[model samples]
Target: MKLTVLGYLGGYPSHGGGTSSYLLESNGFKLLIDFGSGALLSLEKVTDPLTIDAMILTHYHNDHIADVGVMQYYWQLHAERPKEAVLPIYGHREDIQHFDSLEWSGATQKVAYKPEEKLNLGPYQITFMKTHHPVTAYALRILEIKTGKILVFTADSAYFDGLIDICQDADLLITDTNFFANKVGQKWHMTTFETGRLASQANVKRLLLSHLPEIADQDRLVQETIQALNKPIQVQTAKTRLAIEI
Candidate 1:
């Protein structure tokens, strides 16, 4: 399986390097993890969002779902004719409602699925678990049934103790890390320290820190996380075009 980091930040309007979306593909099958406010622009730097096979959302924050309307426009204008355009969308029920309420005009016609239950998209089998957030949210686990490669994506949420159930033995775990150790224990979002500790405890093979707070330095934050972790797992800061094969 091939995984591409299309974007890897939370609050973007980023003046620097970090972006806010992620794309995963294997055997011609494309799956998008999150499409933040700037993701469409960032996505254009990598691949055409109009051609993606499916999209999954972990939450409904503006930074996360802001591109849905734009994506619909892309497919409607730039892509092939009507019969050739189809994309599957999976998200928490509330997320579905929020997007639906946007009444994105022609966009509603493209809904393939609303994640009524555990479902399959392209090469991946998916399972959505609840997460702690102001809005109802989900932590997504995608496993390639044929290869048994598993990847987990946590959208935006505070560190919850029961996270192990969603992340055990994952090949790659992409988590939200929006603060430092001293600033953890907030009502929302996780710090680098908390993420490293959870990844270590989950025993996932690899950890990718993402969704940095606007004030955090990417290099320093990751370095601190690496030192605090002190584990054998592969840990790295996520970036654009960075690909992981599982």
Candidate 2:
């Protein structure tokens, strides 16, 4: 399986940056994780929108779901045929309004899932775990059944022990490190320090930082996180076209 960073920022994009969105593809099957602000622009550059097999949402924040409407528009206007246009969207029941609204528009179909249920999408096996966030949020664990490789994504969350267990030795961990350590509070997101600490404890092979806020110097933030880590771990700032193998 391969992971691609389509958009990496949160809240709103940083200066011209995009909000939370990612694309994953394996064995000719494609899936979109989140379609946030600026996602459509970035997506159009990478691949045909119609090729997306399905989409999933971790939460209902506008920063996360902002592009869902436009995606529907793309299908409605550009689809070569009508029957293949509806993209299946999997979101929790907690965000009933977002699902209902999209389903009613005929742009996407609502697929229901529960915590800890393993969903089979071709060779990809996905599982969800509820996370600590202001709204209903979930963390994803997607495993390629044939390769036995797993990728974990903490869509958005505050510091919590459950995240540590969910990330255990994952091939790659995508985390929301939205603020600097000293400046962050646990009300919504985790600081980069806690982000690094989780990677250290979970023994993740690589750490990909996402949901970033504007910083004067990104390298400084990287250094700060490295210092707090118990052991050296590979760290990369999420960026468009950046791809990782699972």
Tell me, by TM-score, which candidate is best: 2
> Residue by residue across 135-156, what tens digits does model 1's lDDT show?
8778888898889999988778
Model 2 lDDT per residue over 1-246, tens place = 999888888798776778899999999888999899888888888888888999888988989989988887887776474764678888888767776755734567888777668889767998888888889999998888989898999989998988998889889999998878787334588888989999999999999988888653578668767877898899878876688887
Q: Give model 1's TM-score versus the native structure.
A: 0.89
Pairs with backbone N, CA or C atoms under 3 Å apart (clashes), candidate 1: 7-21
| Model 1 regions lying over 4 Å from their true place | 16-19, 82-84, 101-116
| Poorly placed runs, candidate 2 (over 4 Å) | 82-85, 104-106, 184-186
TM-score of each: 0.89, 0.95
Clash pairs detected, candidate 2: none
**lDDT scores for all predictions?**
0.75, 0.85
Model 2: worst 10 consecutive residues (lDDT sum):
98-107
Please report the candidate that would top lDDT against the real structure.
2
Candidate 2 local accuracy as lDDT?
0.85
